[model samples]
Target: MKKFVLVGVVAVCVIIAALIGTRMLTPPPAELDLARSKTSVNGTYLASIEPETEPVSVGPVHNWVLTLASADSTPAAGVTIEVDGGMPDHGHGLPTEPQVSRELGDGRYLVEGVRFNMGGWWELTFQIESDVGSDSVTFNLML
Candidate 1:
């Protein structure tokens, strides 16, 4: 019985080591662009995000401000934006369903209920629709 217990402990330690090793080996993409502003996938609009809180932390919901502008640098108003995101590496969605709660005018929208449960590579995608066109932009965050 004692021998069996010792073997089990060794196995568990090996598994833990392997898990940690894997995580350390596969870091976020080297070229991961962490820019707050980026152009939409279809080149229809330019979107930028600013977290309400400085130095975002895990746990506790927060808010973000999203600004939309045309490719020519004109503020895009009266637009509808949808938010969706998760940790790409973890293969899970965000703990909270963030949404565009209100428009702050001048092409800025208020995003509410943004939360990061874990520290890793996270993606926040915004699907924007306006009179000009419909497009999507994704931003990466590492917490």
Candidate 2:
């Protein structure tokens, strides 16, 4: 009976440990803003992103339309934008190197080569440089 009790206690301890580990790897904060449109960090520009294809899924390449406007709501033309992103919780970058493949005029750019290997909390950051100034915006996505 004593041996059985000892084994049961050890099993309970292992289960507790596993539960704690899972909690530690929980998803991002509940209030993480998954907004598609937001102002740059320094208020230099307003940016928005929309996937060219709806219902983006894992293991597939996709495109996104990125639009930029001035703080006063004017189209930010001829701006240089650098695209980057990663899964914050997983500490891994995008599976593909996405870039501004084309300029669609009227402050819209075609960003291609965006891919998500696994679904989680991902952050897409845009480093934008315009005639006015330079700033960045990060958009959060949950998949």
Candidate 3:
């Protein structure tokens, strides 16, 4: 009877551990209704970077969720915007690569996951290319 009880307890523990591990491995789904600029890239539009808050020093990791708005105040959809300069000087350390966000097809771009390995201001002058003329804008982000 003692041996059977101990084995039962171990089995329960193993099952509980498996369930906990599965839950931990699961990642939260990406938000579909994400925040975005209320503007699209147009000729009469002015592109600028507005920091949501003051930059703080976190580890070597930080993320930025940016939205490209148009002059008419709508999310810029299906538009490819490029940042030339990187980091906080132009934007946040130009993460060595331009963060590409998937277009939700509703005139909004979603830059879901951005990881900055350093802390500083990345200066980036970006240009938007589309069927319309390229619109250049500057972003100064702090990481």
Candidate 4:
């Protein structure tokens, strides 16, 4: 009887551990309704980068979401937007490779894995390309 009870306890413990691991691996939900903070890239198209949280600080990881649209306010869906950011004064890019992990429709792209090691003047450049055309925009942030 003691052996059976011990086996059952171990099995239960394993199941609980598995459940916790699965939860930790789960990705957080995307921010779909972020506000559009515009950055003009030659006035040909309208693009915006909205941070998942407001008042973006220094020395912390953040996910900066993007929304690209035409001048007439149409979402530039199916367009590919590449994100690269660095501190110009310091002469180094972000510590992590920030990427557009997923497209949340309506010209929305989720940029993940962004971390600023130190605070200063940072320039985030977005390379936008699609059937419409290709252009680049840079946003200067002073943390």
Candidate 5:
């Protein structure tokens, strides 16, 4: 009689404590920061946008990709790509006209020596002129 009542009360208290502990111990999700990335390739550069890490930690311009192909947008092979925007005229003290290679398949291209030395927003000019046509795009980078 009295023992049963005591046991039930203890069980109820334990269950309530477990529920309260669960609520107090749960962790919140991590916040995110991001910057948009742009990519271009070949002799034709279009201002394409890419989602990037939010609140990007200031770092060197390690790897910037060039787009060679898309389901609806594709550039031909063997097309040359030139990017100019470091500082004197529009760069951070790098070459005004830098070159890269184009892979055989789509979505494949390269921009050699693409680096950002200091921390600041930088402009990028992508120029592509081939026997096919001429195209260019302008973008900005934050380091």
Candidate 6:
């Protein structure tokens, strides 16, 4: 009985190690050009905000994918990006503070916690900071 218990413990440890190794070795998500052109100041960079969820209605959280690229079509990796926006006509900001959750590598990021309380000409702005410089772009969303 004791021998069986010891073997089980060893098996568990081995399984855990394998899982960790798999995660460490796995590559990040591929960058995709999934949305319209949203460019930074003076066309120094390009950004696109693609909604992952369809029928992006109001009052429900949504997932957005942000893709950044340089003017020369290079991936803008290892950069700090900020997201914020709201109804400009209504003079208010987003109900929740949206943020970049995952760095998918190669200028691709997963932005989560996006909720539009009441949608009517909403603007989603992205501020990017990288080695080149810092600039911002906005996406006008109509719902």
Worst 10 residues of 6 by lDDT: 26-35
lDDT over C-alpha atoms for residue 2 of model 4 = 100
Tens digits of lDDT, candidate 4, 46-103: 8888889878887788898888887788888788778887865555787888988899
lDDT of 3 by residue, 22-113 (tens): 65444333332222222223454444343323353433333344455556656566678664564322232444555545554544444433
lDDT of 1: 0.92
Could you tell me which 10 consecutive residues in candidate 3 have the lowest summed lDDT?
A: 32-41
Give the alpha carbon lDDT tens digit for every residue of 1-143 in model 5. 99999999999999999887765444322331222333344424333423223443344333355654322365555556677775322223553244564343554455554555555555556675555566766665554
How well is each residue in 12-107 modelled by candidate 6, as lDDT tens digits? 999999887776444333342223566786686888777897878998898898999988889998888899988656667999999999889888
User: What's the C-alpha lDDT at position 35 in model 6?
Assistant: 37
Candidate 3 wrongly placed segments (more than 4 Å):
1-63, 87-95, 112-117
Ranking by lDDT: 1, 2, 6, 4, 5, 3
Q: Write the per-residue lDDT of candidate 1 for residues 1-143, one digit (tens) a residue.
A: 99999999999999999987787557799899999999999999888999998999998899999999999989999999889999877678899999998989888999999999988899999999989999999999999
| lDDT of candidate 3 at residue 50, scale 0 to 100 | 33
Q: What is the C-alpha RMSD of each candidate to the true structure, in Å?
A: 4.1, 4.5, 14.9, 14.9, 17.3, 16.8
TM-score of each: 0.83, 0.83, 0.44, 0.69, 0.48, 0.73
Question: What does candidate 3 score on TM?
Answer: 0.44
What is each predicted model's overall lDDT from 0 to 1? 0.92, 0.92, 0.49, 0.77, 0.51, 0.81
Q: Comparing candidate 2 with candidate 5, which one achieves the higher lDDT?
A: 2
Clashes of each: 0, 0, 24, 0, 13, 0
Instruction: Give the distance in Å from residue 136's predicted Cα in candidate 5 to where it truly belongs.
Output: 1.3
